[model samples]
Target: MAQPLEPAERRPANHGPKVAARNRDALIVAAREIYATHGLDAPLSAIARRAGVGQGVLYRHFPDRTAVAIAVLEENVRQVEQAAAAEDAAFADVLGVLTWHLTESAAFLGLLHANGATGHTEALAHALVLSGRVESALRRLLPEGHRLSAPDGLMLAVAMVSGAVGGPTREVREHRAVAAWRLLGVEVGPVRPFEG
Candidate 1:
């Protein structure tokens, strides 16, 4: 005969804030991988499955694809911020960080452009907020004798990277992004490997 199941109270609590946080984090990671592999328009259900969570969990954390995209962008910005936090961080190093992110996660840039084209203020506003943080960091990172102001530098970097790296493959994108940086007279150093 099979053993009886443990009483409900005897078992550990399975649902709570901790589980919710884990589910949300998993969804973000899965969303990043899925979007990178399948493009931003991939199905949301696929993200849920890839995250090993239910659709309900994903919906609870992120109501829509745009919300998911914004979460990914937030994480990307955090990476850039960390790069800039290094004591000897050079503008080229920071540019390398930005270029790596844009190359690895083109969906972030694509979603930003798409939202801007559609006049979706939430995504654009959030992007601008993140951009301000990066620009503030750039104020310190800007190399002496650099012609562009921090704001202009950040804007140009994003624009050039996005425009130049629209290739169908990762290798092509990285190559183009590097070339774009060179074209702008920025000597981007090696990009740090992504930690997340």
Candidate 2:
């Protein structure tokens, strides 16, 4: 007699709220790595592969590349807020956090300014919230004479750092950020060593 046939094991559906949230987090992390290595135009499939999820899961969470980028930016802003909230954190420390993100994810800021960019308003609005917080910190920490007089000063600082992302290497980018602070008449004590 022939051997009996066995039933195939069934997998759980990837549809619950917990599963959705976990998949979204994984996608964001994977997107950050993929975009950093290959720039924003890198294939969305690559991100799904990196996250070990299916294409359907990726689209279910992000819907598009810009959505993934915005999630990454939102995470970056959380880090900035955490750093800013520290009791001993200085304006320079906050900028250090920003520089770290800039070097690691160079193309993120560019997405905000790209011509015909889909998420310009959303990204800029999110960035402006951070800008307001940074401006408050700048006013609190900067010397009277060195303080930026205009309302948009920190946005200018951000623009400077945004410009820095085009440098050849992470070190060059960090140096450019420091140079940007110097141009703004603020001194960042030392460039934080790159860990990425």
Candidate 3:
């Protein structure tokens, strides 16, 4: 038999920051997909497997499910900010972006709601920040004189859109978006069929 290798030879040296960054990104993407599909109660092992990393890597990056949830929420908020910041973006555009994200993020949203019901302070705070950010973005799209009532209108519109069954069909989303615009006193005609 051949001689056995030393311990240092058997295992490669750690790449340090690069490996950690890769693992962190993988975990975030995997968490978003799994949470979108299976909600927050999905096992940590599932996220690790989906990310092609071990539990140790996941824990090193995020100590618990709440940390993972917060990271996902932060990424989602970043996307909303980017979409809302487009040049001359209108209220309808912001509504459409919010509706699309909220519909796609049903499981995450449900988890937040459940956590809020249980008085999870961090989860509740994150939810408020999300709402406030969206409202602020929408307010920026309104005319100078119409900014005063934007918050109430935005909250109502978000409530109406987010309460739909199965997160609302595409047609229903379009309808609700128009309704939200109307509620905000912005005149928008019915959605026309796509002609291609």
Top TM-score: which candidate number? 1
Arrange candidates, best lDDT first. Answer: 1, 2, 3
Q: Over the stretch 116-145, how does candidate 2's per-residue lDDT look in tens digits?
A: 455456666665665566556545655555
| lDDT value, residue 38 of candidate 2 | 85
Candidate 3 residues lying further than 4 Å off, grouped into runs, are: 1-13, 143-150, 165-196
Better of 2 and 3 by TM-score: 2
Model 2 has a clash total of 0
* Every model's TM-score: 0.82, 0.72, 0.70
Give the candidate number with the greatest lDDT: 1
Tell me the TM-score of model 3. Answer: 0.70
Off by over 4 Å in 1: 1-15, 193-196
What are the lDDT scores of the predictions, listed in order? 0.79, 0.71, 0.67
Give per-residue lDDT, candidate 3, residue 52.
91
What tens-digit string does per-residue lDDT give for candidate 1 at 41-148? 889999999998889889999998779888878887888888888877777888788888788787667656655775456777788788787777766777676766
Candidate closer to the true structure by TM-score (higher is better), 1 or 3: 1
Clashing pairs in 3: none
